[model samples]
Target: MRIIHVAVIAMLVFAAAYVYRIKMESTVRTEKVLQLHAEVRKEREAIAQLRAEWAKLDAPGRLQGLAERHLKLKPINARQFDQLKNLPERPPSIVNPGDPDPIASMIEKIDPDIITGSLPVPEAAH
Candidate 1:
C-alpha cells in the first residue's frame, strides 16, 4: 500500500478505537449514575417512612395515654405549693466576706508527692 494511504488507515483505526473506548466508558458511567439515583430515591423513601413512624410515636395524645397507663400519676391540688412566708431561710456562706478564700489557696499549692512516673517537672513560677 502507499505510505500516505497506510498512515490514513492507521489514524482511522486509532480514532475508531478511541471512540469505542469513550462510548464504553460513558455507558458504564451512565449505569452507575442510574444506580446512584435509584439508591438516593430508595433512601429518601426510607427517610419518609422513618419520619412518619416518628410522628406517630411522638404524638402528644399517644404519649399522654402511655404515661397514664404506665406511670399511674395522681392529679395535683391547689394547696400543694407553700406560701413565701413559710419558706425556709437561705444557709450562711462557710467563708465570711471579710476573710480571704481558704479553698482557693489550698488549690494553688501543688502537692510534691503527686508523681507522673517520669523526670521531675519544673514548677510554674508565682
Candidate 2:
C-alpha cells in the first residue's frame, strides 16, 4: 500500500512538471509571436514612410521643375518637319503582295491536317 502511494505521488509530480513545461513553452511561443507581429508592424510603417518619401521624389511637378531647370528643351513646330519627297524611301517588304504567307505555310507544314482556312485578318484602314 505504501509503494502504491509513492507511485501515485511520483505520477502526480511528473504530470505537474509536464503541465508546467507546456505552459512555459506556450508562453515563450506567445512572446515570439508578439515579437514577430511587432516586427511586421514596424516594417509596414517603414514601407509607408518610404512610399511617402517616394511620392515626394516622384511628383510630376517636382520632376517637371527639375527638367525645366536642367534640360534645354523646346516645343515642336511645323519647321521641324521635312517635305515628303525629301524623306527616305520605304523599306521593301519581306513578302510581296499576293504571295502565300510564309508563316502560314510553315504552320501548315507543322500539322498537315490543320485547316489552313482564311482566318479573318484585321486590315489596316486606309
Candidate 3:
C-alpha cells in the first residue's frame, strides 16, 4: 500500500512538471507572436507615411511649380501650330526593293517546314 502511494505521487509530480513546461512554451510563443505583430504594424505605419510623402511630392501643383522653376518652357499659341502639308517631304526608304522580307528569311532559315506548312497543327481545345 505504501509503495502504491509513492508511485502515484511520483506520476502526479511528472504530469505537473510536463504541464508547466507546456505552459511556459505556450507563453514564450505568445510573446513572440505579439512581438511579430507589433513589428508588422510598425512596418505598415512606415509604409503609409512613405506613401503620404510620395503623394505630397507627386502633387500636380507642386510638380508644375518645380517644372516652371527648373525648366524653361513657353505656353502654346496659335502661331506655334502648322499644317501637315506645309512640312517637308519625308526621306526615301533605306531598304532595297530587291531584298526579301527579313522575318520570312529568318523563319525559312530556322525551320523550312514552318514556311512550307508541313508541320501538323494541334486542334484547339473546346
lDDT winner among the candidates? 1
Clashing pairs in 2: none
How many backbone clashes can be found in candidate 3?
0
Q: Which ten residues in a row have the lowest lDDT in candidate 3?
A: 107-116
Which regions of candidate 2 are displaced past 4 Å?
Answer: 91-126
The best candidate in terms of TM-score: 3
Encode model 3's per-residue lDDT on 4-123: one tens digit a residue. Answer: 999999999999999999999999999999999999999999999999999999999999999999999999999998999999999865544675885655555564345445767778
Which stretches in model 3 have alpha-carbon errors above 4 Å?
A: 94-126
Computed on alpha carbons, the lDDT of every model, listed in order, comes to 0.89, 0.89, 0.88
Task: Tell me each candidate's RMSD, in Å, in order.
Answer: 8.9, 13.3, 13.6
Q: What are the models' TM-scores? A: 0.72, 0.68, 0.73
What's each prediction's clash count? 0, 0, 0
**By TM-score: ranked, best first:** 3, 1, 2
Relative to the unseen true structure, what is the C-alpha lDDT of residue 77 in candidate 1, on a scale of 0 to 100? 92
Query: For residues 41-120, could you state the per-residue lDDT of candidate 2 as single tens digits?
Result: 99999999999999999999999999999999988999999999999999865544675787765555575555567886
**Cα lDDT of model 3 overall?**
0.88
